[model samples]
Target chain A: MSRTGFQLPLLPGRSPSEPPDTQDRTRALEAKGASEQVGARVRRLFGGSFHLRHVDAGSCNACESELKALANPYYDLHRLGIFIEPSPRHADGLIVTGPITLPMREPLLRTYEAMPEPRLVIAVGTCACTGGIFAGSELVAGPLERLLPVDVYIPGCPPSPLTLLHGLLLALGRVEEARR
Target chain B: MQLTWLWRGLRTGVLTTRYPRRPERMPDGWRGTAVLQRDQCVVEGAPPSCVTVCLPRALSVEETGGDRRLRLDHAACIACGLCVAACPRGALSISNEFELAASSRARLISEHRPKGDRAA
Candidate 1:
């Protein structure tokens, strides 16, 4: 199989799409906005490589699928010099999905604090953007904006890979965000 | 040998979108975010009918100043088209403008000014 080309035969055993978890209807809210200074900081710090840490505070994992799709041949975000980092300590950006639940709040903030300065926080998906439909629930401590300064808001039940790309680029200050 | 893969690659063109450089668009009739056709809205009652059908509370009637307006919050909407189907006036329709990322929550909301009315 050519690594450059997508092969249909690969990963035949990957699990089917999971339904949205009603009980875990992640509740979070959008919080703060970053100054233009943050964008300049990102451009300087990342240079050509953007390292990100993804935090799933309380999502149904749909956004995770789209984030995974970025690695595939179709989206291929890696070619743009963007990467997902496992440790927050090494990241320049934090991309969060799902509504921040009660249990995840401390850890989410801890992860945010763990990152070095000039950190960019991107709220991915409806839940992290607006508390989404899960806004009224008692279980959520989110809209990520409530917790941290969100530099980009990618609002979707789950954002598409292309939308995710747009958000990432917006965070990098390479593209203009398309407001509704 | 490796030639098969090259042949396959040749057959399949570049799959990546022109996004960032060019805006991506969904196909026509693609059900994405829903918007209220303000000019066509014939709000007859205290609350618009679409509010009841919207499961996520994405649609709501807001009273501002002296005017009553319908607010559509895209982030809360699932694009299920229930509001489109439920509206008797066909005032609600699905839009393909799905590149709805914004820097703030307020940008995701659009308050429509109704043009017509059906009074009780």
Candidate 2:
């Protein structure tokens, strides 16, 4: 069977400790079919695909850098049927980074309000989840969850590119999971 | 040309990580998260053993009626290897568990009771 649309660059479903099998074609075929079905369902949820608008809510720029790396050849998040969009109006999801400061509170809400129905809010990095080291600050107003309905909370100082991919996949799973 | 780049791509195999779908191990000595080896912990000292040395305060000890419980908040942790080095009994060390994404706030906090106090 040919998997034409399957382009998950990361070696999913295979353990590194296990030696590579050259004669396990049947087992490999079954695994591929399962992940492909999941991919197809996820694609249908957003009507072919969806766009994400990332907002830096007064972050230290570390999360932003990791977010930027997703588009590069190494990570390549676009291959997974999701994209980084420029406009909130065109986006179906929001990837928020850093602790939301007083100045960013109004803009963040405006961006969330701009998105259409079935919108997803993903809080990336430690600051965005629980404000990390910047919790209970005088200038800060949010940890992303307090202001919006966050679907996923990726807790890391600056989550690695792969972690962001996993979070996006989890959010996609949630959309389908909720409907069921 | 685009064709030349395409040829270069075929030469260089896939480099993306396989995490979440499958476990990915971080490099040796890589500080992903702090772990408190409770069995090795000498609970004879006053409460808040390694909590004072923690820079982010991810480690904390709450003494409720003489029972000291060391709490490690993964959300607040910055992955700094301070607590591992600061432990006088050498009970703390770094582990390769970096995929710590969660949907709720309370799930991120973990508690470790010393050998004798297992009630709480």
Candidate 3:
């Protein structure tokens, strides 16, 4: 009922001037709950070391390329104290890319299960967040959140290296301002 | 920052392709699509190495007489560079032309004969 800063239109049969009770009920159901707002948690761990491990379930390699590009000279994400680890045991965060396919479901679950407590999952790309174009495919069993709690979501078909860097920074609570 | 920006700008210009309006010259070893050459095919029951070596199983040969007819399935092709390596007669070579857009998927299948081949 409330347009506010929302870009998408309200569903059909829902009037903008709905009663307060109706609006409250709708908002309660529609809200994405609350995420640990970017700045608060990050302030406590500012300048702390963080290791990321990337997982590709069944992507077209576009997202993986962008993720790799983050370490390139122009966008050296490692300069921000973020390192990409090869194993879950060494990682403090999981960066998942791709629409989780049926075969990849078990492996993704196993990888997430292997990570220790206090770990975070950052779903990078539309595929990982909401399954993107492959959302309803028979072969797809995910939108990573179905199996694990995703702490941060970076939305893009294949998010640019800079966008990914921003999301990681946001997850770490380093980027507090609403710059984008 | 200025030096990095300048370097990136130069790199972007160099990497950009002149596509759609201007035809792009595909770089060396770029796999465009598979082409069928019916002439150089050996029809005397000799094994067609091109067909056998196709990683995607995209190439097939039909024996007629002294000439063998070759057919290529572009959709099935993964462009793995095996078929080109198997062509003993040098009849098959990877083409650099990658502009394979078509209204119908069937048009992607290239049916071309080797140069100076009368049978195709």
Candidate 4:
């Protein structure tokens, strides 16, 4: 059977409908005021190309889903020069999700130590930030900051992809810093 | 060539959000952050009813300088929206502001003391 494919020629560019205001607001909110120095230092070291190592200390997997979305096309985190490295040895930053579970404590610590100097540990999701709803659970080991010095706190049951992007940008000093 | 993929792509458009610059368009049931209304809590009653229903126990009433104030740990909150719905006096409600990231843990905490109830 012979068939003709329908084709339309359109300029290849970001869709015009993706409203600019919302994205700007999210960026404004991600601005960290006091970390200006840290961000600048980090940017100089990595040239804004942040290599992240993700670890799920102990979580319900909600955070992982959002974390994965960072690599999706719409978010296009790669365009910003951010990447998820498979090994802590190659990573410049550790993006942790979930509450620090009892068993994962050792593993998490090892990952942090494995990272190179000028390293950053970012606690993404409410769980990693403050134990979240799992705080009182006997099986939980509390927040990540209690164990490792956290550089950035992205608080949410699970932060949105844009929030994650902004948090990374904040850490690298791509955005303005604010205190609040 | 079918070119069906191109047609599908054009129809679906971009699925990503334009957040940060403009505010996110949260759905009807989408739950955001929580805020405590001091005056409303007093009218409903001290040690607000929402505290009891809070699953994570993230909300607690503490006596500061002889005045009972509600403390909310934003990091511990799951954003389940239970407290927001449980409040009889509308003292607790979920805000549209979802960007809760901060450099310090202290910034995530919110304390609301009853209006006009000065600590001695």
Predictions' DockQ, in order = 0.44, 0.22, 0.02, 0.31
- Candidate 2: misplaced stretches above 4 Å? A1-47, A174-180, B1-9, B16-23, B42-47, B65-67, B118-120
Which ten-residue region of model 4 chain B has the weakest summed lDDT? B17-26
lDDT of each: 0.76, 0.70, 0.61, 0.71
CA lDDT for candidate 3 = 0.61
Which whole-number lDDT from 0 to 100 does residue A16 have in model 2? 28
- What would the per-residue lDDT of candidate 4 be over residues A98-169, giving only the tens digit for each residue? 887777766776776677766777899888887777776777665776566677888777786766766787
TM-score of the B chain in model 4?
0.74
lDDT of 2 by residue, A32-140 (tens): 3332343455667455675789999999999989888988876777767779899999877788998998778767777866776556778998898878778888778
Q: Over the stretch B1-120, how does candidate 1's per-residue lDDT look in tens digits?
A: 899999998999788866777777778987568987777885656666789888878888877565767889987887889899889889889887766677667887888766542231
Worst 10 residues of 1 chain B by lDDT: B111-120
Candidate 1 docking band:
acceptable
Candidate 1 residue A67 C-alpha distance from true site, Å? 1.2
What lDDT tens digits, residue by residue, belong to model 2 across residues B1-120? 999999998998677754444566667875556777768875545644578777667888877896777888876777887777778788888776655666556767777777677554
Give a tens-digit lDDT track for model 3, residues A1-180. 466665443333434233234543443243222223323443455635678788898988888998888777756666666899989988778888888887776677667657765567788766776676576777887777665666676654466565576577666655532211
> Who is ahead in TM-score, 1 or 3?
1
Which 10-residue span in candidate 3 chain B carries the lowest summed lDDT? B99-108
Better of 1 and 3 by lDDT: 1
Each prediction's TM-score versus the true structure: 0.81, 0.75, 0.46, 0.76
Native-structure RMSD, model 4: 15.2
CAPRI class assigned to model 2: incorrect
- C-alpha RMSD over true interface residues, model 3: 15.2
